[model samples]
Target: MLFRQLEYFVALARERHFARAAAACYVSQPALSEAIRKLEHELGVPLVRRGRTFEGLTPEGERLVLWARRILADRDALEHEVRALRTGLTGELRIGVIPAASATVTQLTDPFCTEHPLVRIRVETSLRSRDIVDRIRRFELDAGIIYADGVDTDGLTSTPLYQERHVLVAGSELLAGSTAAISWAEALDLRMCLLPKGMRGRQLIDDALATRGLVAAPQLESDSVATLLEHARTGRWACIVPRPWVSTLGPTAEVRVFDLVDPVVTAHIALVTTAAEPASVLTTALTGTARETDFATVDRRQR
Candidate 1:
């Protein structure tokens, strides 16, 4: 029943290992286990399945974890609000963002921090767009920057931030200059390296290519954008990336960036948050700044 016990339960559920969960909670293994036992006794339902080691949570535990997370989140929000009233807006604002939208988070934070310099910002990058939505729904993230397409927005609201235009980046061998734009078909024939098919960016590219009845056969598949760009720098392979991500690199003489045409597929990136009213002070600030700020103005100068 205690908040500390719920915290331990949630940590255990997340870690899926008792020792590691205890370590994360800064408590000994036995202490964490005993706390969970007490929690289960108070609730009159077994939260965890017993075994030799840390087994998975029961169905009831899974449901309880969700409620526990919401309770903790509300508790934190109350603290943040009271503290903000005493001083100013001051708390950690956690943002989950996909890899392509990672560089664009500063567009929201820069203006937000200027208004409330006391707030701390943390951005988790390279997440699947769907995962970002899930985490926000669970209150694990204050907000997220994700693609608007193909994401479940049932309990959430989105504010459009910017449009992501696909581009092809290649070394000198494949593309000699940055002057010309190439079709998705032309780009696919070359030796290419790209993100995995599971990523939102890759899915967008694949969907666009499918319209032309083509499939991607990458020379290399990587989760990191830096890796793809590194290969492209060698002038041996070409990669597809977002235009804004390319813009963050400024002038890249080692690589050529060409716009993708012949059905230019664009995805709108938005700031997504839970639709619950009376958002935490930090999220309110972020959502407010995102609404008023112009992405082009903030992003164009980011480089």
Candidate 2:
């Protein structure tokens, strides 16, 4: 059968309703049903249980669904490679990244564009890890930069890009009267600004603070770290942010980042791509730049 038939099968298998499946396939229900019937006849297998409504796929149908996903993915990859041969590194690379790691993507994108100028780059920022992986698998996004821990990447491959280092940032007023490091107990009293609870970074923060049986009282929550830093600079605010981002501050004359004492926390971020297909040339180069990026925090520590 053709790729369109397999596409129709996967859409039907997922929705289990003719109307919904057809809508997802961007066709009329009658059109989708005919295609499925054609596919079953060609394969000589009963693929779906039919009546007035779509019931479910048979055992053989379920197995074909799995194979269909693989075949479709490979088919798309082959088409992209062929197009690249004629066009030279042209197509689209859709990248999803954790909202906290959004800023770092700029570093990779610039160099990547230089290498594959013909490719179009799209970036989406999301706070959830599962959502990132889901988007990557469903063909919504070509790749994602996300936390590697506790994310199920069943058919995805990852290369560790950097270790996101954590640090304590506070209003200059708080730091002026205190030591170089801020202990957890001492930080409990300050007005904290953290990423919304949806982010994995916030979960890491909770994990770290749970040891002392203390949770932060966030007076403000934002997805953008730059905005959080601006709030700290302008108000009596304190935040625990990744150390690598400190360089973004033009000068921390009005703000101060202190070491979080006891056990310092770090999050490992990686570039993830679907394992089923060879990456398009643009995506491959983009992911490679991600792998080579120097999380500046590491170098500063080395010095």
Q: lDDT scores for all predictions? A: 0.86, 0.80
Where does model 1 exceed 4 Å of error? 177-179, 298-303
* TM-score per model over all chains: 0.92, 0.76
Global local distance difference test of model 2 = 0.80
Clashing pairs in 2: none
For model 2, the stretches where C-alpha displacement exceeds 4 angstroms are 11-26, 44-62, 134-140, 152-155, 174-176, 196-198, 219-234, 244-255, 276-283, 297-303
| Per-structure clash totals for the candidates | 0, 0
lDDT of 2 by residue, 264-296 (tens): 788888888887646655567666787677766
Q: Name the best candidate (by TM-score).
A: 1
Can you write out model 1's per-residue Cα lDDT over 57-150, one digit (the tens) per residue? 9999999999999999989999999999999999899999889877678878888989999989898998988999999988889899989987
Each prediction's RMSD over C-alphas, in Å, is 2.1, 4.0
Please give the lDDT score at residue 95 for candidate 2: 86
Model 2 lDDT at residue 98: 84
